[model samples]
Target: MSVIDILVPAGDVRRMHLLVAERLAGKGHDVALVGTDAPGIARTLDNILHFERAALRIRLDSLLDAVPQPLLSLARSGAALRVDLTGSGRPVASPALAPRFAGSPSLAEAARLLMLGRLPDIAVVLDGGRPVAEASPMADSRLSVARGLDDILARVLTLLVIETHRYLDGGAMDARPAETAAPPKTPTSGQMVGTYMLSTVPRQIGGAARRLAFKLHRWNVQYRFHKGRRVADTGLMAGEPWLTLPDDGDRFYADPFPFEWNGRYFIFVEEFRHGGGKGVLSVAEVFRDGAPTVPRVILEEPYHLSYPQVFAHGGQIWMLPEGGAGGNLVLYRAESFPDRWVRHSVLVPGRQLFDSTLLEHDGRLWLFATERDGYGSASDMLVVYHAPALEGPWTPHQANPVRIDRAAARPGGRFVRVGDRLVLPVQDGTLEYGGALGLADLIELNETKVRLTEPVPILSPIRSTYPKIHTLNSSEHLETVDCIAPMLRGGLRRAG
Candidate 1:
């Protein structure tokens, strides 16, 4: 028992390590499966122990044979190792030299000891057989992923470092990381991860050397099956990295909302303004983007002030915005461009909900709601209040319908923090509309006393209409609409 060693870069091809050496020989442990397969399926399984050894051949002209073939056939079947480079149906052959360690010294410590103290802890990158990357080894010990890569590298590492700089989009690439978190809203050094793994490329990968040649086969399948998960007491460790978003503002961007004021960071979006009731509550000072000098207003309101809830407390800067014009929840106060702000006082009474996210936690100030019960097709609610502060005698956490879930329970935006834990960003609503980005986990903040130790769904349903179109000029009028849209199971099938 206790003898494992794996590193099959498309060398095995899909027996995926015989379901992991038949579940580690049913826990009696003793598996040792090296790469480059083709033999009668590793001598037909049993405590495993195969070592067929061959390594090298994913076609980049054999990539100098992706070097490394030592200790082949597991020391002639003596088996006393525990290494697994994941991806087991073979074909990856050189998934960037799989987690390295034919005698490893650094493929980021051989992809972080294969994956945190092993036992199939992870590294399952499959393909036609399913899985597609579960790599891990960007560490954060003061720093080391060779050096930064998709934050949550714990101690530091900024944005998607290595892993081919995660599909590239530094656009405003700032380093910042002096070990952050010391009043950086209680940061104390960076770390982020809530769920990751996405690659379908080609929608636009024809520049920058064919996007770095598909980013070297996407950084050897994201440095060997992407991994950085760490969340128990939430000492911070998670980042949802993904953003190629910038198709020249895709005819006027829409869903953006992500906040954390006073400490510095803001998004507050919704920007269409082409016609009808009009729209535009845009503001993007996230490391500074243009067109946001703080003056924007074109929200008339038959249905448009749209999903905003801004907050900063004590020093000022508070907002509640929703589709006003007598729909309710107004309150504003920036005086200059988080879009100038100003007006102040509306809080409750109309436009019941199209989006509203705000959380104060523990001492209490929660409100994560979503409505259109009128059959706009979506229903999710979680509202509770309790204020001796945040301006009000506020009260309403008598367990006021904390959930109704329309699939993954809507409400996606705002409420951020990883170390002290408290994160909300939800949305997996029954089907679409930015649906899939959940994570609630044992929340329990006081006041209206709310609870949640399970909300899961980390960013699902992505059919990509540039992130499931929430109406950014409706794809430029769709040919002036003449007919066609009545399909149900295959989507968009109308013709009226």
Candidate 2:
């Protein structure tokens, strides 16, 4: 175990700092908390946070939570390595610094982004003052400024904890250079005060009132299908004459996964009823005349289910729908095709895994999903697990969360293979959950390493009636997608 020191601003230590120290210590490291004098701007930032919380009535976990006396006693024990959270770019006295940002602190910049009505990019960390690790953190876009700040900070803290573990394990870190362009100028005290007074405060109040007015209106997801377009033929284009899979006034459908079995085609989805309050797996058969039968419930559980990833293997059909709420990765086998399914095996147990997807490559089955470790958005961290077969033992990748990006981390639909290239359907949740869809090229995948090209924009809700379009999949003759829009209570639809 290595003796590591976490450096934070003196007289400004927050709960996040203590949380980091506790996590490092839990990993069997000798950890110390070191306090350094902070810049004067830190006080201004704190005051701004306080003002926003009171003005917006945002109830956030106090950042000033007191640290345990035992942990606080580990201060200044002379550790050789340090992790800097101070946002001060000063040279540290330690022999090594694993991860620190090069520019203004992430929190300050994030608050500025919120003021500008924009999403903040995930913070990048550096080793020896060189860029080493970076991933997109996820936050709810529909929150007040104070609440949004808290959400982003929580996700950033999770990312830091993961990176710290990787650093100590001698794992391979991304060696990419930091972006050369300087970040936007930090807002001055006068600018902050003026903007909050003239813009942010009023906008937030109006937004809150509007939300309350629409509280009874529910956001519903619906699936769309198009014929004569195979998965390979549909490139980065929109405006196809897609047919909407009609839903009853009571329920909605989403996460469409299209599959071709034998000579029949089917589309599986998550059918969620307003009163049920949870989703169940459902499937609809598509006829050759471009019509779909009513989707019927195929599977239900005590907990929620969605994203029915159906495929054929070992001469039998199997479905792996997301069971994140159940805290396990389960496989279901079709006793009767497109209908009866029974539990096959528990591939993974006791974990909150979302949108788990399987890919067969290099003679192994690779599973990809975003993990929720009791905090932060489940849409940011892309983790990998692989096994030789469908059941039994599965091992997590060395770089567990191979990617951390809100724009493309969550799996939207089935993987499409076009000749030599593999395209991954990804959910762009930077602005809103399922706000758009993008396709990422899988560059490499193996037992030890995984790489993916940045996602290219494909479909979005811009200039469209739908507010969000997330899932995308296709069979030989039909392509499928799902989108979200608001519907009035009691099953009345609204035209956007």
Candidate 3:
């Protein structure tokens, strides 16, 4: 077994670095946590947390007091070493002193040796963006202690684990050596700490406002055609009469997934009722004469469901809808066309997976979804899993959460093939969760790695009352889109 060495800021009251060290120890590594700020970081686990969270902490703090000596030895043992400088004091600006974080040169050399397997080490630097939640000009303005601190830790640790696995798998390391340039100088010790505080006040206020505004907004479906053309080739849908499904007073429909079966066109959507606060999967047929049949409630679950991803596979039709709230990837096989469906199997259980999508290529089945790791938005990470068949054991992609951009990580609609490329609709949640939609081409996909090209915004149709659209899907002869528009609270208000 390899013993790993980790560096953390001294006197970290938040205990985030300690939590990360504990997690690493849980993965079967003897971890030595060295403190950079003060000597208290070298304290034993018993002196830190109570007995309940002590197992992993005990393992990480085993050699906590050995100082920087073990870090060099662990470097020679092919053990993973990580340097975490988050929540540390910034260097006072001086002409003679290097502005870079102290001991970063050692981190760079360790990373180079780690890549060569001479000594496996991974250094993580938290990019503290402009601090959030500043009530006063004199308030602490550092990136530490933000409202999403736990979420940030989750993301960084998750990335660390993924990158570690990548290196272990003989894949190229994503953690490159640090630059030789001097780091930027920060405020001195006397300066008020520039870190932000993590408070729920803003979110609480926002939530209450949203509850009030929910009375006015409802989602509706839209449709158009691209004829297999790329976004650059398929210009904007200007002056076109976008189609929409009629809205009911109690429910709203969204996550439109359209597919052509045999000779007919069908769309499956999420019908969310205001009273029950649960979504039921519904399907509607579109006629050639520009008319939509009354959508029939096809599948109903005790828990919420949305984004019914439907496709034909192995002489049978299958559906994998968003059952994230149920904490499972629920798959349903169409027993009787679009109406009668039965629960086939649960692909992944106990994971709060959102917008699960399947793609069959090169004799392998790929599953895509956005996972909520911590307290941040659910659209932050794009996780992937693959299997030899639709059923059976599914293996997580080595590079799980392949992307972490809030703007384009969430799956929005179906994945459509255009020539050699596969275009998938994705949600841009930086504005708001599922606030807008765009299209990204799946550039490279394999068992080990998955990559998506930059997304091009699409389907924001001009001259439409529904200003916000977030989901889009297409078939050979049929297309589907969804948008949010305001409706009266208790009754349908006709547009004046």
- What lDDT would each prediction earn against the true structure? 0.36, 0.73, 0.58
TM-score for each candidate, following the candidate numbering? 0.27, 0.85, 0.70
Model 3: worst 10 consecutive residues (lDDT sum) = 132-141
Best by lDDT: 2
List runs of model 3 lying over 4 Å from the truth.
5-19, 32-80, 89-123, 126-150, 164-217, 224-235, 488-496
How big is the positional error of residue 443 in model 3, measured in Å on the Cα after superposition?
A: 2.3
Best-to-worst ranking by lDDT: 2, 3, 1
Model 2 lDDT tens row, 13-113 = 77878887888899888888776675523556677777777866766575434345423334455564677777655656644443322245535666666
Model 3 compared with the native: what TM-score? 0.70
Q: Worst ten-residue run, lDDT, model 2?
A: 94-103
lDDT per residue as tens, model 3, 1-496: 4445454444443344455556666676676655455332212222322331242232222212223322212222444444333333343111001101122312222212221212111223322212111110000111112222223334545555544333334553333333555553332322211110122223334545755655644678876544554332352445335677776667778888887887888889999877777889999888776588777799988899888989998999999999888888878999999899999998898888889888888889988898865333466678999998888588888777677666677888778776677887788754444567778899888987798986888754555566566787777766777776666555644342
Pairs clashing in candidate 3? 100-183, 140-194, 141-194, 141-195, 142-194, 142-195, 222-481
Candidate 1: where are CA atoms >4 Å away? 1-4, 9-33, 36-253, 256-309, 318-337, 340-359, 363-411, 414-425, 429-496
